[model samples]
Target chain A: MVKNRQWRLISFPSGRPEASNWELVETEAPEVAPGHLLVKALYLDVAPYMRGRISPQPNYAAGVGLGEVMVGGAVGRVLESRSPGFAAGDLVVADFAFGWQEYAVLSPGDVRRIDPALAPLPYWLDLFGLNGLTAYFALFDAGAMKAGDTVLISAAAGSVGQIAGQLAKLAGCRAVAVTSSAEKAAWCREAGYDAVIDYRAAADLPAAVAEACPQGVDLFLDNTAGPIHDAAMQNLALDARVVVVGTASLADTFGAPDTGPRFLRQILVARATVCGFLFSDYAARHEAGRARLRRWYEAGRIHSKFDIAEGIASMPDAFLRLLTSRNLGKQLVRLEGD
Target chain B: MVKNRQWRLISFPSGRPEASNWELVETEAPEVAPGHLLVKALYLDVAPYMRGRISPQPNYAAGVGLGEVMVGGAVGRVLESRSPGFAAGDLVVADFAFGWQEYAVLSPGDVRRIDPALAPLPYWLDLFGLNGLTAYFALFDAGAMKAGDTVLISAAAGSVGQIAGQLAKLAGCRAVAVTSSAEKAAWCREAGYDAVIDYRAAADLPAAVAEACPQGVDLFLDNTAGPIHDAAMQNLALDARVVVVGTASLADTFGAPDTGPRFLRQILVARATVCGFLFSDYAARHEAGRARLRRWYEAGRIHSKFDIAEGIASMPDAFLRLLTSRNLGKQLVRLEGD
Candidate 1:
């Protein structure tokens, strides 16, 4: 029997997550049952969305209960299998259902087969997984992005942010990025953004966004819904479309109410539409989206940078880094290297 | 030359209008020019949207300047015509450009001819005019009201609200009304709402809304963007559509920012869409919309009630009644006998 080490939620976060809120536990990995397989976590993804899973609020999904294994996604390898669909040593990727652990017992339906030979294992989570699917549907479907749209993407150097900017560029839109640092802004510019606003360095975010989009933003792909959202609200072109994908800046207030200048007036003034969507809504067409994303990746039309931490012990820290917007790209913890 | 009495904006309001903000002026009416017609005002419209036009804010339309005629809509009879499209004795309806006056000078393009023989003159400003068309397009296009949708309409006894609630019922959706008082709620019930919530009397607004809409609101027609908006935000069903049609409650704060719970989190949690649109955006298709509304009105499928204040002197008071939710159905001012 293989030994499994996993992190379990001890308490819900009051504000930002604390290390004491999680407890590490060791147990024997469960033997495979009929129609099920066991996977050893290769690389665990730490995303901003995970913060919602720990909060007791009206989230899109059910929250992780106290003493429950902390939820996450990971690229894993099949260690043992009782299902005909999977064999030992086969590579797989699990989304959200994969807890923050060294080993997870899952059914064949719980995971998708992935080929490491096609690209690096971490790339499945970073570029070809949730981030890619999210950016594609949120930008084109929710945002109604079209040719010549002035697309403003917040969190432009992060996982989904990077992919959305490149996709906007591919669609012949003027891609303007709002990132936290000069280095990330430089990276965004090199990645084909028409203009980059380093939000942390700007004296006035709304002015910076206005300067970058002189004609006003036609499609604002909002991932950070705080000051950046307010700035975009103040600079919408006629009939603008805003897609709310993530609230990276509001992680601390997930379970409580936060105040901001109401956006309804701006929405009316510009005749704009604001929509909120989750990637799971497009799960049926994931394969199609992944195919186009893979083509873009192979042709170097899209690129991704991995910001990885060392081990299972770094899971909470990696997530904190993501919550604080410290990670440059996809934040991941390597339980074992690819 | 005709003697005319009109109300001019003397100052912008800080909160609600207090009757001291308008100036009554008596002057000789301008004669018909090369392309303009002179009309004697019969009925003037008082609406919630007019509140935005008086404020110095980023509204959908420009604010009425001090010393300018208080902007409004009216049904009138042409006294003299200098345009080929119209003749003396023609009945017409002018929108926005028709001031709160006894006479107006307008170009042929500024007004639409009305057949007084088809319906009562006041119906042109109520059931068969902006109110009906706004309800039609907003419910179908912006609210995306599908058959069987549980629709929640705020300010349900107001002009557009009454029409929208009925339109949702005609489309086979469950029409629910949120009104200010029990009397208005009773009117909404008589008008075919499946449920009615008297927001002013509700001990817990959210609880009242949830109890009324046990299945949650599928389409929320937001007319008053304050507490009613918050209650609806707390109870959105999956894939709900929220159409911001008017801001009756926010009128007092139109030129300044107001604090409210941020709605992005609620929006994302429900995977919902919120859109803001103006009836002017559908101006090109107004004729078709008016025809349908006329058919509905003639068929007894739709209804309208007029809460009219007498004479041009009552214009500001009639408008203030609308702003304070003191008037029900289509608020109007009769400058002359119908």
Candidate 2:
């Protein structure tokens, strides 16, 4: 009999999640139920949104409970199919709650058919998936981005920010990136960002942003809603648009009182607009967004990097990389690959 | 020569401006320039926005300089005209930077002609002017409030809030008012609000708002950006809209850091939209908006009250009343006869 190994939440976290908060459990691979497919995970995504799911605070989606499989996205190969839609060796991509496992029994509706010939397996979890979709909707729909707009993206070298910067360039907008390390800054510039602010080195973030964007930020892709958000708020142009894409910086402060300068006056003075975005909100248009992103990728107009960590044991550290912004691209834990 | 008695800001206040912060000065009215008109102040307005202008902090407009005439709106009569657009004794309404003065040398372009036969002189400064314009644009343009929307308006007994509440009802929406006193709550009900919460007495303002707005707030007219704003933020419905119309609660906190729960999670969870509003953005639509407001007033479909403080000497206290929300209606300092 084959064994199925999974990581389950053992406790909730008050601050940064630690490796000890999770437990790796081993059990026999469960018998596939009728209309369900038994799949083996190949690539697991480590995304910023997972921080919200593991927190004690309430999130947009239900939080992971103690003893439950942690929720995340993954690309997998169907090993056995009781469902007619899937077959043995067929590859698919899905954001499943049972992501931290070697094998999962999933309903056919839980995943989408994906071909590796179109894109790499990990690409399905990165540029062709939620990250790319976020950047698209954030700039075009939520931000109402126009040509020549000065777009500022936080976490600029990360998967979503990199894609957003490239998309901004394609639309004739100047993109400025905010990152922590010089390595990330170089990557962001290569991704078409006109300027990159190493937030760690920027003594005065607001002034640095203002100097980088002399005309003021017309569109702010707020991937981290804390200090970077505040600095961008202080530099919005008249009628600027702010799309709250993620809260990497506020991961620990979500339930706590986060202190900052009152922004109403600045908002009023700039007549800015703030919109909160979740990729799921555009679920209806996701397939279409993926198609468009795929087209851009083939045209060589867009590119993304995956900061891959090997083995199931690296999953905890892979996810932890998001909190400290240690990953320069889309982070993934690869269990088995070429 | 007529005497021009004006209130000049003598000092910038640390917290709330006291009566002593302003000094009344008497000077002879200057001669009108070739294109200017001499105007006699009839009804001088005291508005919440004036608080922003009086503060030393930079605002949408330049702040009132120390030893400079305080900035506000006024309705007056042309004493003498040196410009072709106006004539002597013509009644006009203008939001002047020198509104506290009894008489002033003016430019014809500085004022708009308003007939007293159309509405009361003060109505030009209230329902037909900045306050009304603010309400119309905030709900219709910025907030994007639709029919059947559940709207929560803060500072509900004040000029902009009262007007916004009545407009919300006229649009077939459910209006909930947030005010400080029982008397103000009654006035809000009289203005067509279905629910009124006395914020001063409510121990848990968020709970009270949630109870009053059982369906959750679809649109929030945030007239004050402080505790009330936070309360509304906690109760937003899916895809709710928040239009910031004032910062009465942030009057003293603009330059200082204001601590509150990090709202990124709350905002993203609800997929909310927040917009900052200013009436000047709708300047081109003023005449059209005034015409609509005048029709509503004539039809008895809308109503507002003026809390008049007598004479130029009372201007300081009249503005001071705004800080404490002591005035139940549109606060104005009357310098002329009824």
Candidate 3:
């Protein structure tokens, strides 16, 4: 009988997600049903949004239930298959709840086939996976980014931000990166952003952002909302668009995320749009993102970065580090040894 | 020699305008300069927007300066013409400064020739003038109202709200009017609103609005911003448009207007737009509104409601009445001799 390890939410988190909230559990693998494939996870992504899933607060999605496997996207290999579409040794990405786990048995329809010749396994979790898909929809679909427009991205060193910067460059836009550290600024510049501003170093962020973007930002991708978002609202040009993706700033202050200044009047005066997007809402466009990313990856036009931690037991720690901005790109935990 | 009387601002008011701030200055008849036409004022339209002009705070336009005629729009008869377009005895609408006067001189281009047969002098200042034009653009142009959409108008008993209600109805929309009292509610309903919610009676406005519009509110014309705007933000439908036109709530409040609860997330989550628009911004469309209103007025498809007070000296009291929610429709003043 095959054995698998999975992380279950032991308790709801009080402030930041703690080790006690997550408990690793072992279970016997289910008998392979027809049209189902068994996946052995290579890399599991730890996104900042997952923090909201562990907290006991009203959020866009329900928090992970106590004693349930922590939900996430994973890049894996098809170890065994009872489905016609997949076979042994095939690589795939799936929106499986088997994250922080060793192996999972999922339906063939749940697994999205990936190209190994184009990119490595972690790229699936970074570029071709949720991060890349989110950046694509938020920037192009939601923000309606155009050529020559100035695009400011918060958390510019993060997985989604890196991809968005490259995409903006490809679209002939002036990409401005707002990062918390100087190292992240360098990372963003290397990724082809026109300008980078260290949000941490500035006393007056709105003035700093305005100085960086003299014409003001036309499009804003807000992942980390705090002082940076408040400044972005003030420095927006006419008909600006702000895409609200994540609230990672909530982690810094425990439960009370800093309430930024009211920007409705500014939005009205500028004729700008501020829109929030849940990734799952665009399921129909997944194929479009997949096709585009595949082309970009095949052409070596985009880069993917992963900050991986080995072992299933370190999943909670890795997620906590992700909340504290310890990881460089996509934060992930690999269960290769277990 | 003809004697001309004009109401000029002697001092700027700290809050609501008072009679002492203005002085009725008598001067010799203004000579028609090159490209300018002489006009004898017939009717001056007193609008709520004038309150914004009297304030010291910076707005979309410059505030009323000391020792200048109070800015307003009026219907007048051309007493003399130096400009090529205007003829003597021609009835026209002028979007110019100092409408609260006996006689004034204006550039020919500033005044739009009106059809007295289609819509009388009062109609041009009411339904076909700035008030009606503002409601049209704010509702249809800026808000992007579509047929069968649900619309909610705050301060529904006011001049702009009443016309907006009829316009929304004419466009085959489900229009809900929110007013101060039961009497105003009845008037709004009689004015052809599909639903009327009395703010004083409804404790839970969002629930009441939801009950009235089972589907959701697709468009919101905001004049009063306080609890009503907050409630409306909570229940906006997918892709809703909230147009912030005026803030009557600010009129009663002392000191700077409170920032209030931030609804930026609500705007984002609903993929909605909250836009602020000024009627003067679309001065080009004034003629179009006049033409449409002319046809409607001739056909009796639309009507104008005016709360007329005799004597231009009563302007201060009329303005106070407008601030206190005592006036039902367009507030105007006529010279006592007329």
Strongest candidate by TM-score: 1
Model 1 chain A weakest lDDT span, ten residues long:
A329-338
lDDT per residue (tens digit) for residues B246-284 in model 1: 656666765464456343433433334544333234445
Query: Chain A TM-score of model 1 versus the true structure?
Result: 0.77
Candidate 3 regions with alpha-carbon error over 4 angstroms: A52-63, A95-98, A250-338, B10-23, B54-58, B96-99, B247-258, B261-338
lDDT of 3 by residue, A63-163 (tens): 78888877766667888999988999998887445555667888876777887775555655655555555666667656788999899998777766777
* DockQ-better candidate, 1 vs 3: 1
Alpha-carbon runs more than 4 Å astray in model 2: A258-338, B258-338
Q: What TM-score would you give candidate 3 relative to the actual structure?
A: 0.71
Best by lDDT: 1
Of the pair 1 and 3, which is ahead by TM-score? 1
The global C-alpha lDDT for each of the candidates, from Candidate 1 onward, is: 0.68, 0.67, 0.64
Q: What's the true lDDT of residue B72 in model 2?
A: 60
- Runs off by more than 4 Å, candidate 1: A261-338, B261-338
Query: Candidates' TM-scores?
Result: 0.77, 0.75, 0.71
Question: For chain B alone, what TM-score does every candidate structure achieve against the true structure?
Answer: 0.77, 0.77, 0.73
User: Which ten-residue region of model 3 chain A has the weakest summed lDDT?
Assistant: A271-280
**Tens-digit lDDT track of model 3 for B1-338:** 78776667787666654567677777888888988889877665455555666667544357778787777666778989988888999988775453556678998767878878754455555555544555666676667889998999987766567767877886789999988777678877777889999988998987988888787778888766667776676566655677766665554332453356343322322323323222223345534533433353346433323345554234335434533324433333333242
Question: In candidate 1, how many Å is residue A293 off?
Answer: 47
What docking class should model 3 receive?
incorrect
